[model samples]
Target: MQILINLDANHPTFPPGTLDTRSRSLMETYIKERFFDNLMYHEAVQKDFAVWLEAHQKNSQASPKGKRLEIRKIRSAAEKGLNTTTLLGEMERLHFDARNNVPDKQINFGLSHLIDTDFLARMAKQAGNPDIPITQRRGLMLFGATLMVGIRTSEWTTARLISDNPPVLPGETAAHPILVIQTAKTRKVDPEPRYLILEGFDRGALGMIEACIEMTASMTNGHLGQLVAGMRQAMLRVADSPEAFELIEHIDMRTARKVFTVESRRDKCSPEAVSAALGHTTTNNLRWYAQGDIHCERLTDIPLARATLNAVKKVRDPLADFNERKQLAGGKPLSGYPDLGTDNPNADLDNRGSASLANRLINPQGNR
Candidate 1:
């Protein structure tokens, strides 16, 4: 799939002595037209599925088993593609490829859709209001939590508050709340569940989540999923005013997540810390969203930095002795603890043996 997207018709291959300018021209024209057609089809398919899903949802109760099956099939099929998996790397790389001068705007990563923390605080306050409709309350909570904790929309179906036995950090006397959620896109590998610790300002986030779960308790899983997914648009109807409404006009779940990612890094949080907060097993996603170090200070004088520099400088090129060592180890890399030998200054044991061993060798007073 990526190969098709990256095809370069300008460099066409041909057999020896085969001079065919017509074939070369034909290939170039075909590739140009093919990309255009694919782009159009992608756009059309998205619009078609959205319309179909809306219609199906309106007639959900009245829709027959066949219609329901079709709706599910269409939704699944629309989401299945290389684009989803390659979003963080391969697709992003295509934009920087010199061969294709793709404009930065053409690659929509949603990194610029930053939501104001003040606005999020306002939504959080609204989420606690009991006078509003339950749906509206849940919608606000959904939006707030996504921005606060970086919860993916799909994970909402399985998200729940697990405040029991909150782990207390060092020097902290009281335990804080925790939001337990299954990491999305990782159920296949049975990945460990992620627990988001809610402390200080974020302590109320768990309460709002609890409220959302309590109100939707009786709802079926399918209905719950639908309601949670709709919160992206439903949130606007619950907005406080024209300003709040306008703020979220172009925002979706992904955009909310992007705001969280960008804001976290902007606030000087470490990339590894942000990745952990986002429930990612690695910093790969963090790199894609934030890209590069947020803090640019070069601290080469620090102890660790000096130690690392010294260690790196001491490294000998393995290729220099490759030929001599290759046959000695049957072309396999040798593995063992290098510091255990006598050459190590830190090792307690030496070639002569330990002081205790020397003491025993003296046989206490004299040789018995």
Candidate 2:
């Protein structure tokens, strides 16, 4: 007589003891939805999945980074004993082959390359004029705000202006007007929303932003996306002019940030201060924006060589006292030329005639 051994039913690989009703239900449901008849969980499968993920290209359609994140989620679910084998198998089968070495798309625009303040002022003035279309005016207002803040287009669009507790008195200046940026790119490192202080020439930037918000409040339905887009278009039109075309070939959000970074350095702001203001965790990232040819037109006026020479003279005596030596050492002229003046009488006569003719031509009445 042969005894029937129920090896499948009493599998040692399964977790021991009865799971709670919810856990059991979840596990059963996951297994039923995902697993096939022949599939089974194995340590080797997990290893293979990890190796495949590492070898895969990171720039594929699903993005390797994104896929890795999803894998992490599956791993977490599996650790909870909810469809462990099935989820691991699915993750292993996923295609993660994408290019990982794609170069960064950041384009650094130095201060020299960006449009000057005169062009910006012209655009702002035209935008402020009542004769222009309201839509164009609104766009110019936003553009002025962008130029002033040097923020990303998305940030510019989403940013809100909150006045100080006590409104700035008329005919008086506000030291720092606040610009609240809702969505920042570096939220992972710096989670808090940025409240930027606007000072100097940028103080009016917030006013322009507020004015734009007010003007388009009805048309935008409280969404600044359309307003932002219109502003970008308007800026492009302004850039298209012959005078500004060379300086501002295109209006790029990244370029705006780059210009801001360079200008901040030019204004003597420390790297730490600039990085903090720009919502960056490290000054290393600021290098990309700050590493550009400095506008040294004013530096040329410094007389560095002359100043260095003067400094050296103060430290040491002259190599030779040429002034004193000049009295001691006299040199004789060359003996070959006896007379330096014009010797030919006919040549002198010719020169006098030419001179008299030139004088007569100048004063015809005197000539008579």
TM-score for each candidate, following the candidate numbering: 0.41, 0.40
lDDT (Cα, tens digit) per residue for candidate 2, span 184-270: 675476465555555443435445667755554455444455555555555655564564554344444455456565565555454
Clashing pairs in 1: none
Candidate maximizing TM-score? 1
Assess candidate 1 and give its TM-score to the true structure.
0.41
Write down the lDDT of every candidate, Cα atoms only: 0.47, 0.46
Could you tell me the lDDT of residue 329 within candidate 1?
37
Residue 79, model 1: lDDT of 43
Pairing residues by index, what is the TM-score of model 2? Answer: 0.40
Q: Note the clash tally of each candidate.
A: 0, 6
Clashing pairs in 2: 57-97, 57-98, 58-98, 59-98, 59-99, 60-98
After superposing candidate 1, which stretches have Cα over 4 Å from the reference?
1-114, 121-134, 168-175, 201-203, 215-247, 291-368
lDDT of 1 by residue, 177-280 (tens): 66667778764677756666565434355566676556555666666555455564555655666755665565556555655665665554544456566665
Model 2: weakest 10-residue lDDT segment is 299-308
